[model samples]
Target chain A: MKGFSKLLKKDLILILNNYFLYVTLFFAIFFILLVNFVIPEDTSIEQSVYVLSEYEEGNKLIDYFKEQELSIRTLDSREELMQYMVNDFNSIGFILVDNQNVEYVLQGYENEKTKNLLALNIENMFQEFTNQIDIKTTYLVENNTVQKIPFNKSIVPLFLVMEPALIGLFLIATMVFSEKEEGTIKAYAVTPGRMSSFLVSKVVLLIILGFISLFLVALTTVGTKANYLYLAAITLTGSIMGSGIGLLLSSFFDNISKSMIWIIIIAMVLSLPFASYFAPNFSPALIKSIPSYSMMFAYKEALFPTGNSSIIGNTCILTFIIGIVTLILANLNIKRSL
Target chain B: MIKVNGLYHSYSNDDNYAVKNASFQIEKGEIFGFLGPSGAGKSTAQKILTGLLIMQQGDYTIDGKFVDFKKRDYFNKIGVSFEHPNVYKKLTGLENLEFHSGMYDVKTEDPMNLLRMVGLEEAAGKKASDYSKGMLQRLVFARAMINNPEIWFLDEPTSGLDPTTASRIKDIIKRKKEDGTTVFLTTHNMYIADELCDKVAFINEGEINIIDTPKNLKLKYGKKLVTVEYYDNDRIVNNTFSIVDEAERTKLNEIINKGNIATMHSQEATLEQIFIKVTGRGLE
Candidate 1:
């Protein structure tokens, strides 16, 4: 442990002197500025639902929704709803002529799949509400409904994944290659210091870097609203996993030049979760199986939690194990190769 | 302080060995020079002795403890100066030594003192990346001594340097030997071996061909010759004659006793010549 502290001290100095400190700070500031200023606050493309009743039975159908206090806008006339939908691309209009004949009017932008999904969802709700009104049983709202995530704020999870998680893979590899190029790695082999200590120290340094980036980006973008301790835990898991993988891959090659392709390849593969993060329905079982997918969602829970905080616990536990395994493999390879 | 019995190393896990059936012993305070050209087994042997390469098919004991290279104590008592300068390039000379000083569990020499010993005190604060190749070599040499090792392994310690710096380094090695540090010196340069080694081994093609003190090898294989300088046809002429042959000895004596003789000296086989005679190959 004492030896580990000494190696950590040396590695910190190397990272500081190599200008990586400046690079990380620069990137953090850039991301903070980007999230806060460059991206629009509400890029929400979710169109509002508009409806109008023309017959007496349609009024009963409208009353059912009105009692529920949904954001379903009720207009005076079908033409009025159509005008609102035409002017506002964020709106979709519905006309309940007699409940058996319903009409949906759009601004002509939604895809066929999206239109069908929206219609199917409305039809299910229509059926449920109509059944409830016929039976006349009062329904109670659930207490655990999470708040909606704003469009710009939703992108922060991707930033965490890219900066403190994915970017760390390359950073740790760079540090390893720096030591290899300087031949200090072989110098270390002759030392009484344990190789495990040497490897763990590198991971610790990367975690420190990761924490700094996380704090700067989070505070500037999300302010003091996040679960900081949970954020820190997720970041810890991410850095270990990133640095461990970087070390493992680097152990097989002699220098960064030979390993750069594979490094980029792994990073790219790990980044496949961003697809699911942006479009949740796009998630296939394969992408969901990736650790980064869980890490991305876990960071979301930490940053802007929507009550499913258990994801953070599960992701941290699983990634921590995987991280440790990679670190062990990296240690063995370095012992054999270096 | 160091003993190896029939060490064998095969990188491919097959019968083709980089070092085969090598055995040697170095007593406390004696300098054992391992002499061989490139691709010979000197490096493989030195690496094994220094705990860089694991002992595959042999027995090794350092300071009377059977060597376990995985043990921290194996490195605690030994130091290695590589042929290549392998120090932290971003660190200053002093910082490099100081960092290496921290790796050992034993008491270490002052980093500044090691720098002074290596004549790098003036440039101690300069980053090693900015240092010359010789300066970097000196820094690595200084680092190897930071622990005041009981056994020191030096490979081509003075391969590149001016005569003055090389002599200073050689003097340090001599002082350390006097202080009872066992030295395993590997180099292709015969001059260093001829000057420093108490006993030297000549190895080639993964095997040790000969091991003996330089003086004994000279006596055993050297041809005693006398180079005669004398006046011939109104100009100074030079000729070499074997003193052991009766006829050549008479001629040499005749030249020596003559008034025309200007200068004469005895000659013996050099270490390189003896190496060629034993291994049938030259040091590259």
Candidate 2:
């Protein structure tokens, strides 16, 4: 156990000296800032126009339109106003006063929130006004189901998929291969240290670094949720599996450059296609089979209500994969002599 | 003490045996030198003894207990320094020693002390990457001594060192011997073997050509005679005489008393000449 601590200490110091920890932290933070820039926040007000005629109800509606928070501009003709709205909708939308009914004149992507806010407020005012005159007015509102998932919400899981491969796998593989080339791996073999303990230390260090990298990215690019505990579990499991992959690569490839190429290839094959930009409707079977895919899906499900399977299943599969790979690498490493 | 009997090893399934039917033993506190040219299987034998290379056939034991290569406990009792110094480039000399020391069964000495012992104390804090080959070799020597094991396995321990540093390292080996540590040294340096080894084995082509004390081999194959040189009447004269006869000694004494004797010395063959005589090939 004492020897184990010394080995762990040396491993940690090597990691620190290599600057991998700092690189991961920097990449995570910089990536967050980059993603934040790509997705701008929405704070502008909705602008639309409602037209009214000189009829009693329309006059009442005109009076009501003046009282709403909608950014309303009035014009003479609906055709001219619609043209103005199309050209400068972001700046101002027009409301026309008429007799029987009110028509909304707005640009091409305009809908209820823009069109109805003013009409509803005006109808409310006219309803109060017509109530005083013993008359009735009906206002129509189109039911629109706009899925308001946060802009970065979907990307949270995608970042989770990338975190393991981009940061964890590369770092772990590089560390192990560096040691192997330096003859430190063979040196450790002659030590009284258990291969399992040595590997566990690496995985522990990798998990901490991996989680810190992914967590910072997760927090900056997308806000954390109430169930951060669940996110952490998923992150830990993914890191373990990713680190296992790294160990397997390091154990197999003596060349660091070749190992890095393999890592990039694996990361791309597993994560890029399942990313939302490429396949929003990624097949459930494919996602379940690939390790990163399941992790990304679980993270997205946690962020939003998208998936049916629980995070527990993905976590279990990741844990199993990690265990098997780690065991194999450990066995091979222990038997590797000078 | 280390012992091996009937050791056999081959590089591959169909390859010829690198070590075959080899056996030797070294008693406690002796510097046993294995002198052989390159490709004589000296390194392979050393690796098998140190547990780096596994033996496919043999009864191998260290300190009277049979060694199971799968276990690491036997390694704690021995320290090995490779002919090629394999040190971490990015790590400082001190850091390399610290890291390797952590792998030992028993922690022994301060890394700086080991460096100082090897005349590398001044360079201890420098990165091994920036070190010269000799400095790196000294640092490896420091690493090998970090744990102070009972047995030291050195393959060409002084290969890249300067003569002074090599002598200093040899002195350290002598000190280790005085402290009752057995050393298994492998080198093609017959001079070092002649000087340091209590017993030297000349291995040629994976077989022990001769195993005996350096003095005994010299006596067995060396000329038993002396050459005398003198100047008589402003002319140089030379005479060869056998040390084996008393009459020759009397004649040399009478000549020395009657005339001038410039130089006189007995002749004994060197280990290199003796090795060439035995193996019919020069030590490169």
Candidate with the greatest DockQ versus the true structure: 1
Docking class of 1: medium
Give lDDT tens digits, candidate 1, residues B198-272: 999998999999899999999999888888889977899999998789999888777767778888777889999
Q: DockQ numbers for every candidate?
A: 0.59, 0.38
For model 1, the stretches where C-alpha displacement exceeds 4 angstroms are A46-142, B231-235, B247-261
Instruction: Give a tens-digit lDDT track for model 1, residues A43-146.
Output: 74665888888787777777777777767787897668878877887888888777687887877888999889978977987888767645555546566567
lDDT tens digits by residue: candidate 2, A229-248? 66777777777777777777
State each model's CA lDDT, in order.
Answer: 0.86, 0.74
lDDT of 2 at A41: 56
DockQ score for model 1, please? 0.59
Cα-based lDDT at residue B108, candidate 1 = 95
